[model samples]
Target chain A: MNRKGKLWIIILLDIVLGLVFFKALIGASEELSWVYIEKGGIRPDDILSYLDRKDYGTVAIMARSYRIGSKVRDEDEELYLMGEYADLLFYERIFAEDGQTEEAADFEKRRGEIRGVIPEYESVLDDMDQGIEKGLHGVTSDE
Target chain B: MKCPNCGAEVELLDEVCPYCGAVNKESAAHRAEMKHYKERSKNAKEKACGIISENVALIVSSVVLVLLVIGIVAATYVEKNAFMFSHWAARSESLQKSAEYAGILRQYLDSGDYAAFLAFENAHVIPAYEEGYTEFEKISGMATNYVAAMNSIENVVLFGEGAKHYSVDTDISSCQRSIANFFYTYERALTDMEGDPHYGKLLDMKGKMDVALRIYLGLDEEKREEYLESSEGRQKAYLEEVLALE
Candidate 1:
């Protein structure tokens, strides 16, 4: 081809490649934004945040909501289960302290049922029980 | 034409006349014209080569730019699907360790820790549909619904505790939806497990799930049997009553 013809072809290719590059960059940016920004919704740790504040009621509901929202994976399974178990035990104590025997019994029975399912975690349960008895702090708190 | 000196016949391009040994006058002019034409042709050929060489560089650079753009796009695609690729890769690896996974899965099931079983299965990306793991399929399926039901009921019990943080009507509706979904899935699972070899294990899970419902949602054995035998509308009413939504 002549010089002019070759130049025009190169210009055409440049336009096409530029558009493709622009599109790819846009898509990548959108994906990155979603992964970093919009994906930052509730996490299981959010439940623990309420626990840190000693908001047992909020912690209980948040833990349950988190469990229903996310799947149980082995990495987080113990945390999830223990979070719920601690919430149950916490409420059981509160109800008993208030002399609401029936309500307290219900909570006790619920925790027992949970214990029945995860019988192998006796040591963890023992720790949780001790933690609850020690002034009702967070489930995993060393204090 | 004839030679100028001897008037003998000679070619225009000849410098000498063969017949009379004389010089040809037209020979020098003819050679000069040929030389001028050759020079012009050489100049034209060199000009063309220069243009092509310049454009070849342009073309090569453009191709490199195009390749670079494609590479960037491909890298983005792989990045976006990194989780999917990793999950698939892990599943392939798990397929090779089917016996080991099956043993672990059996241990979870035998221990009545359906939640752990599910967690292990999912975390390892076990190939549940493969031949070696197919035996656990029915049980796992049931276990999924059972676990979901258990969680949903727990949500029902806990929602009241956190009423200050949520809208009562919306949370109630959400909990009701979860319960209805569980019952629907539970019914389907029962049908699927009718003749399954894992039916006994499923029954045991169902028993535990029943106890949970009783303790949390206050649905006793008779109430649960009635709920199962009732129609869809009655089931809804029963849930509302049991949940104290009335």
Candidate 2:
């Protein structure tokens, strides 16, 4: 075969390999990204006031098994995290009052960002809670 | 014939087999009974754990029942024990003073002042010298319960379910409860210190008493017998020592 033929064969192999690697990377990233609901870190004061004022996250779902509000344990950090996020969002009023176009745009943007992050973080809630049942079996966990 | 050494057909006259030396089969069933024994061992351990849990449950229930009886019949008991109280109170008070000093000695353990604990023992309080002997007798009794409770707790730990059912499985907690009770009684002993003419000494006594009370309260009895035994412990020797300190 001519040199051109060999070069073309090499290029074809590289293209195939590149596509395979890209697909694998996407598959792995998607698994991690969608694992849990994510709420960013809480501000201590925001949480304190929320706790003080008796504001809480509306009943939410956890671990595919529990209903967020009444069924799950009150002390679960996942619920607490959600409650804090909700309080901040409620306190700040992400949605505008007057229905102005400019205010609504900012509200929509903020809402979109929070919506994007949520499922990735809170996943740890059920994992930590059920970790022992899953045979994490840490020394004191049974106690 | 096929040659064993090489897996090739050989002439009838060839002496050596060319292929691998294959051993004859050994049966796959060896140690089957050993496995049964192992399973039985595991079952036995679990049974033992169940027995431990029941024992712990009985002990805890009995203690609670006794306390309930005491609370209910407290008035009658007080009437009967009244004459004993004056004598006991005097003793209780003396023990409390000793405990107060011991409280300071315990602090010195954490502060890394072995000398402080040692020094406080021999120091002459205006009224008495409750020093080393009384303190030693008191602690030795606490240590006995601390050890016994700890041993009993080990059995409970074997019963994983029991630990979950009884939050007070650890010996440390029993000791801690004793210490807390000890502190209360210790505080009562300080009634004598109130009559001291020196304001500074009275204030100092007050501070020590408060600190002692707080320490007793904060002790994680699940872990510390010394703290729990500070009050009223199950041991008679400890009680005797505490009675002397008062």
The top-ranked prediction according to lDDT is 1
| Alpha carbon deviation, residue B125, candidate 2 (Å) | 16
Return the lDDT, model 1, position B163. 29
Q: What docking grade applies to model 1?
A: incorrect
Q: Give per-residue lDDT, candidate 2, residue A10.
A: 54
- What is each model's TM-score for chain A? 0.48, 0.28
The sequence of per-residue lDDT tens digits that candidate 1 reaches over residues B14-35 is: 7788888776767889878988
Docking class of 2: incorrect
Model 2, position B36, has a per-residue lDDT of 80
Lowest lDDT sum, 10 consecutive residues, model 2 chain B, at B154-163
Chain B fold agreement for model 2, TM-score: 0.20
Report the C-alpha lDDT of model 2 over B1-246, residue by residue, as the tens digit.
554445666544333433454321221233455578889999999999987775664445455555544444554444444434443444455456765655665564333222223323322121233443343443332223332332222211211111122233233344334445444444553563344323232233233323322222222334234634443344433323322211
